[model samples]
Target chain A: MAAQLKGARVALEVDNVTKRFGGLTALDHVSFKVYEGEILGLIGPNGAGKTTMFNVITGVYKPEEGRVIYYGEDITGLKPHVIARKGIARTHQVVKPFNELTVLENAMIGALFGTRHGQITEEEARSIAMEILEFVGLAEKAEEPAKVLNIQEKKRLELARALAEEPRLLLLDEVLAGLNPTEVAHMLDLLRKIRREKGVTMIMIEHVMHAVMNLADRIVVLHFGRKLAEGTPEEVARNPEVIAAYLGDPELALKFVRRLGGV
Target chain B: MNDTIRKLYTRPSALIAWGLVLIFVVVGVLFKAGLVSLNTATIAMDLMVNIGLALSLAIIMSYAGYVSFGHAVFYGLGGFLTGYIVYNAVQTAYTANPQNFNLTFGRALGWWLEGAVLGALASAALAGTVGAAVLRLRGAFFAIATIGLDYAVLYLVKLYHNPLSGSADIPVTQLGAIEGFFYKTYVLVTVFFIVTVIVAYLARVSKFGYGLSAIREDEDAAEVLGVDTTRYKVYAFILSAVLTSLWGSITVWRQNSFGVDIMFSLRESVHMIAMNVIGGLGSFLGPTLGGMVYYALYRATLTKLANSQFIVVGIIVILFISLLPEGLVGLVKLVRPKLRKYID
Candidate 1:
C-alpha cells in the first residue's frame, strides 16, 4: 500500500461510543482511532456487537453515549446521508443492492450524491463507477441487474458502490463472511489495492481471522459489546483471554494459528 | 431489415399496439363521418380517463411499491370540482335568460378555458393535501387508509343535496354549441393524457425517480445510502394524485354534473386498478394499453352482455396476475426474443 500520508491526520476518532437496543447493550463505551491510510480490523464472536458498532459509526444507529468524530469534526447522530456526505461510507452485513437497477446505475447513485453538494457530470460518474467495478473485478457484470449477482459479487458491488463515494473512512461489515477461499483472497488484494491507490482508510468488521489479520494494521476484539483487546495481530493472537475464548472451538483456533504461520 | 422496421419488429407487441390504435382511429373517424353513430368514441374517452387513473396508480405500484385502493377518491373529487366550476359558470351565463348557455366562438372559448384551468387547480390542491396524510402509511395500512378516505368523501358528498351549491346534479340552461363543448372536452382529455406521459417520463429518468425505485426495492438500504424515503414518498403521492385529479375534472365536465354515485363508486376504483394491471403495472405504457383494451372490451362485449362484462374482466385480471404477473408487456417481452431467434 502507498504510504503517501499527505495531510495525514486522524481519519476517525470514536470517543467512548455506546449503543443500547432495549434491554441489550449493543456497544459499551467503545473507543478507537483509525489513522489515515490504515486498515483496522474489528473482530468478535457472534453477538459481540461488531455489526452494531459499525451501524453506530456509519450513522445507521446513534450511539446512546459519546461522540463519533470524523476528520476532526463531531458527526454524532447525523443522518446516514449527512455522514456519507462528510466522507464516511459503509457496506451492510447483509448486502443491500437496488435489485431493479442495473449494477452501473446503482453505483452511479453513489458517485452523484455521495458528498455534500458534490456534483459530477453523468459521464464522469459512469467512468468512476466503471473504474471501481473493474477494481472489484465486476466490470463484466456492470450492465446486469444487481439482484442477479451471486453473493460474492453482490458483496463486491456493495464495496464498489461505497468506494465510488470517494469516502475517506470506509466501514465494511462482514464483506468476506460468505466468500469462498478464492473470492476471499481476491477481496483481500482489492482492499490492499484500494488503500494503495485511493489512500482510503477502512474499518472492517470481519469473522475470518486470516483475511483481516493480514490486512489490518491494528486489530480490536470485542465480547458482549465491550472491548476485549486491542493490539498488533501477533499480540492479539497470543493473548490468553482470546485463546481461552476460542478454546471452546478448538478447530477454528487451530486453523487460525496455522494460517498465521508462526506469527 | 432497416433501422425503422428492425426497431418496430424488435417490439412486436408495440407494433400490435400501434395497429390497434390505428384501427380505433379509423373507426372513430368513420363514425364521425356518419356511417355509424357508434357510442364507441364516448367509451374511448372514458377509457382515456381510466388510463389517467391507472397511470397514477402505476407511480405508487411500480415505482414506489405502494398499492392503493382508494385512488378513486381523488378521481371523484376531481370530477366533482370540475363539475362544480363549469356548471356554476353555465348557470351564471344563463341567469340573464340568454337563449342558449352556449356562447359563440368569440366568448365561449375564453370562459370554458378559464373554467377548465380553475377545476384542474382545485383538484390538484385536494389531491396534494390528502396524499400528504395517506402516503405516510405503507402496505395494507396505506391501502386501507386510502379506502377509508374514499368512503369518507363519498359520505360527505352524499350528505350535501343542496340544489345550488352542494348537490350532485346542477342543470345548466345554456350549454354552449355542441361542437365547442365536445372540442373543449377533447382538449381537456388530451391535456391530462400529455401530463400523465410527462410525469411518467420524468419519474423514469430523474434522480427523484431513482430514489423512489430504491425505496421500493429496499427502504432501509436506501436510507443507509442517504435517500430520504419519507420525502420522496410524499412527492410521488402528490404527483400521482394531481394527474388523477386532472382526469377526474374532465370526466365531470363531460357529464356536466357530479354525484356520489359517479365520483366515489367502487366500480370506478376497480376500473382504475384493472387498467393499471392489464396495461402492465410499473411500465410506462402499461396503464394506457390496459385502459384502451378494457374500454374496448367493455363496449363491445359488456354493453351487450351487461352482467357478464364484470365476470369476464374479473377472469382476465385473474389470468393476468397468475399467468402473466408482469402483465401484457411482460408477455410481449417473453415472445419477442424467441421470435427473433427463429427469424435469425
Candidate 2:
C-alpha cells in the first residue's frame, strides 16, 4: 500500500517519520509516498497530529526519528525556506497572511523566494504573483491589505501565495476548516481545476470527510499519531477501525458516504 | 540611478515633499554663506544630524520590524573610532611630533575619510555578530535585549578608559579651519541625510524591502514562503548600523571632541525611537517629518517647558503611543489615503 504510486513518479516519501513534543508523541512512524499529479488526503480526528505531519514535512518541525525525502534527496532538518526552495510549499491551518502587506505583496513573496530559480526581477515577480492571484480569484482584491480580506478570501490568498511558489508539491493544512458550505464547494472545484490544469502533487490535511472523499485520489488515516488506515476512498470508508476512530457512529458514516456521492 | 530618480519624482506629491526638504537645506547653506553667527549654524547642523539618526534606525525598525533600543551603540562606536583617529593624528603633528606638522586641510580631510571608512566597517561587523545573536528574540523580547545591551555597552565604556571613549573628553583640536569644518559638516550631513532617505526608500519598494516587510508581517509565514529570515535580519541590522556609524563619525569631526556621556547617550536612542514612532514607523517621510516637528518644539520651548527636557519629551511620547499609535503618517493615510503613495 505504501510503495504503490500508480505508475507515477514519487514526489515525496516520508519514511518512518516520528515526532514528539516533550512526553507527547505527535507523529509515530508514519510513512507515505505522494505521487505526482494526485491529491493525497490526510484525515484524522482531533489530537490526531494531522497538522504536525504537515509541519514536519514543511520543515517547521523536525521529526525526532526518520527522514523526509523530496525528489530522491533527503530534506530532513532543512530550513523552511530551503525546503520551499526545493519545490515544497505549504499553507498554514491558521491562515497566516502578511497583515501589513497588500494581498499582491503577500503573493509576490512566494514568487520571489519560493520559485525554483534564484534572483527574479520585481516586475517578473509581480506578474507571476498577479497570475497566481487571478488563478485563485483574488485578483480583484490585489491592492487591499491582507488584513481586510474575509476568511474565504484569506484562504484563497493563502492558496494563491503557495501556488505562486510554482511548487511541485503543495501541502495544504485544513484549507476547508473555516469556510462556509458554498465556499467549500467552490474551493473543491478550484482544487480540482488546480490538479487537472497544473498537474501538481498535493498532500492535504482535512477534517471535511465528504470533501476529502470526493477530492483526494488516495486516503491516509491517522489515529494517535500512527497510520490507522490507507487506501482508496471506498476502502477507507469500509475500514471498521477508521470508521470507529473518525466517523464514530455508523449512521453518520452512511450520511458522509452519501454526501461524497456514495461508493 | 535614473530609475530611482524617476520613481522619486513621478509620484504625485514627491516633488513638493522633496522640494520642501531641499529648501530647508538650501536655506541653511545660504545662511552659512552669509557668515551668520555660529549659533544659528550649529542649530541647523544639529537638526540635520538628528534627522540622519532618526532616519537611519527606521530601516531596521520601520522596514525590517526589529526595534533596537541599543542602536546608539553603533553611533557611539563610529564616533569613538573617529575620535581616536583624530586624537592620534592631532597629538602626533602638534604635540608628539611638531617637526612633522601635517595639520593642513588636505591632511586632516584625508584622516577624517579614513576614520569614517574604518568606523563603518567596525560597526557593520559588530552589528552582524550581535544582530544574529539578539535578533532571534522577537517583538518585545528583542527590544528588551537591545536595552540591556545598550546599558551593558555603556557600562563597559565607562569601565574601560580608552583614548577614544572615556569620562574625559578627547581633544581633536588640530583643525586647519574651525569654520570650514562646520560648513563641511552641514553639507556632509545634508548628503548623508539624502542618502539615508534613499536607502530607506529602497528598503520599502524593492524586492528586498518586500521580503523584510513580510518578516515584519509574520516571520513564520515569511520563512515558509521562502524568505531567509535569519540572513535578511542580519543584513538589515548591518545596513542600519553602517549608516548610523557614518553619522557618528561625522559628529566627532564637527564637535572636535567626544566622551562616553555624549557619544553613547541612551537619551539619543530614545530620541530616535520616539521620533520614528511619532512620524510613522515604516514610512520614509515619517521619521523625517517627526524629526523636524520634534526639533521645532524643542527649539521653540527654549528649555523653559520643564525642569528637564527629557521629562517633557517622555510625557509627549507616552501620549503619542497611547492616543495615536499610528503616528503622523498613519494619521495622514487615514485622512487622505490617495496621497499616501506619494510620500513613501
Candidate 3:
C-alpha cells in the first residue's frame, strides 16, 4: 500500500549532511529525501542521531558538511524562526508548551508571527488559534493554563502550535514516545487525518515500529548519524541490515514482522 | 461584570491600589500644607524610588529570567551623573559672583532634566554593552558578573572624587530654601511611576512581552517557537537598566547628595530583588505592591531599629520564600479563588 505512493515529488532534499560536536561526529554524510504530501518515517535507536537529523533539517544545528535543500532552495544554516517562516515547523521530544501562557495564547503566538508576513490582527490570530485548538480537540481547554495539561495533551498542544504556523512541512520528533497504546492509536489516526485533510507533508521520528510502519509511506533508517537504509516501509522492514542493526534482537524483529502482518 | 472586576483586580490590582495611593497623596499634601510637620514625607517619596528599582529588577528577574545583583551599578552611576550636573551648575553660578548659592528649581530645570535624561541614556548604553557580554552567561554566573561590574564602578568613582565639588554628604541647606525643589522631586517620582506602569503594561500585552515570558518559561521552546531569545533578553536588560537609572537620578535629586557607599551599595540591589520576589514574580502589579508594602514596613517599624532592619527584612524575605513563593500578589491570587467560591 505504501509503495504505491513512491512517485510523490521530493519536498525536502538533504545531500551529504554531516554534523560534528567537539571531537565526536554526530552526523556523518547523511542523505535522504522527503516526498511531498507523504509521511516519511525517520527511525533509529538511542544515540543513532535521529533527533540530530531532525535538528539539522529544522535549522537548529548546522551540518558541517552538506546542504539542506527545501523545495529547490538551499536552506543550509538558516535560523529556526527563518526556517519556520519558510514553511517548516517542528515539535520537541519533550513537549515545550509555554507553561505560563494559556493553551489559546500559546497557539496564538504561532498564528501571530510564524511567517515573515505583516502583523496579524488580534481577532484574526485569536480565531485562527481557537480553530487550531478545536481541530486538535483542545477547544474545551482553550482558556486553561498549559502547565496543567497532561503529557498527551501537552504533545497535542505542541502539534496544534506547529499546525497553527500553517507550515508546508511539519516535523514530529518523538511525539508518540510517551503515549499509551490507546493514545498512540488516536495520535496515528490524527496524523493520518492531518495528512489527508490538510495536504501537509510530515517527517516523524519514532522508536515505535508498529505506528511508523502503519503510517509512513517511506522509512529512512539511521545508525550513528549515517543513513543505513532508505526505501518503502516494507523494504526497510525486510532489509537484513535493519535486522542486524537492531542487534539481531529477535523480539524487536518479531515486533516489526507482526506490525507488517499482511503488508 | 463580576468576572470582569475579578479579572481586572487579579492582574492589575494597581488600579484599585492607586485609590489608596491617591488618598495617601492627598493626606501628604495636607500634611505639607501645615496640618503636620511629618518629616516622614521624604520617606514616602523615597518609596517611589524603591518602586522604580523593584520594577526594574522584576523585569530582569521575573520576565527575562536573568537575576541581576548589579542593578546598583546603573543606579549609582545615575546618581553620580546627576550630582556632577548639579555640581557644575552651582560652580557656574558661583563663578558669576553675587553670592547667589540658592539654586532655584526653575533656574536648574534645564540642567536637571538634561542630567536625568543623560544619566538614563548612559546607564542604558552601559547595560547594553555589558549585557551583550554578561547575558551570555546564565544563572549564577550572570548574577556574579553584574555584582562584579557594580563593585568596579564603585571603586572607580571612589578614586575619582572631586574635591572642589565637595563631598557626597554636602548639606543641601542652600537648595532647601529654593521654592518647588521638593515639588519637582515629587513630580519626577510621579513620572517614574507612570513609566513603570506603562512598561509593565507593555510587557503584559506585546509580542516581545510574550517572547520574554516564553523565554522565562522555557528558552529552548521559545527559540523553536520563532522567538529570538537572545535579542529579547538584551532588550529587557537594557530597558530595565534605563528605568533603574531614571529612579537613581530621582533619588539623588531628592536627597541632594550622592556617595560611593550609598550609590554602589549591594543592599539596594538586594532590596530591589526582595521587593520583586515579595510582590510576585512575572505578575504585572507584583513589584509595585511589594515595593509599597516593603517600604511601609521599613518606615513604620524596621528602620527605627537601624541595623536590626536587616535582620527583620531577612526574616520577612525568608517567610515569603518559604510560605508564599508567589509573594503578596501570589497570596492575593490564592485567596481570590476562595473569595470567589464564597461569593458564588
Q: Give TM-score values for chain A, per-prediction.
A: 0.91, 0.95, 0.94
How much is B198 displaced in model 1, in angstroms?
1.9
Cα DockQ of the candidate 3 complex: 0.43
Model 1 chain B: ten consecutive residues of lowest lDDT: B1-10
Question: How do the residues A1-263 of candidate 1 rate in per-residue lDDT, one tens digit apiece?
Answer: 32443356888888898899999998999998878888888988899989888788778899999999988899999887778777888898899998867798788777766763246665677898899898888999887778789999999989988888888888999899899998888888888788889988899998878777777877888888888888766667777787676434655655665676443
For candidate 3, write residues B83-168 as lDDT tens digits: 77876777778688757565668767566677788988888898889777899898899999999999988887777775446454
State TM-scores per candidate. Answer: 0.85, 0.93, 0.91
Q: Model 1 over residues B227-321: C-alpha lDDT tens digits? A: 77777787787777767766766665566556657677777778878877877655556676777777776777766778887888788889988
What would the per-residue lDDT of candidate 3 be over residues A1-263, giving only the tens digit for each residue?
Answer: 45555687778999999999998888999888887888889987789898898899878899999999999999999887678778888989988888867899889878766763245665677798999998888999887779889999999999998888888999999989899999998888888879888889999999888888878888898988788898877678778898788526656666665777553
Model 2 off-target regions past 4 Å?
A1-5, A261-263, B1-21, B35-43, B96-102, B162-168, B173-179
| Candidate with maximal lDDT | 2
Error (Å) of candidate 1 at residue A261 is: 8.2
Interface Cα root-mean-square deviation for all models: 6.7, 2.1, 5.3
Positional deviation of A163 in candidate 2, in angstroms? 1.2
Off by over 4 Å in 3: A1-9, A116-118, A247-263, B1-14, B17-43, B100-102, B164-173, B337-344
RMSD values for the candidates in order, in angstroms, are 5.0, 2.7, 3.9
Worst 10 residues of 1 chain A by lDDT: A1-10
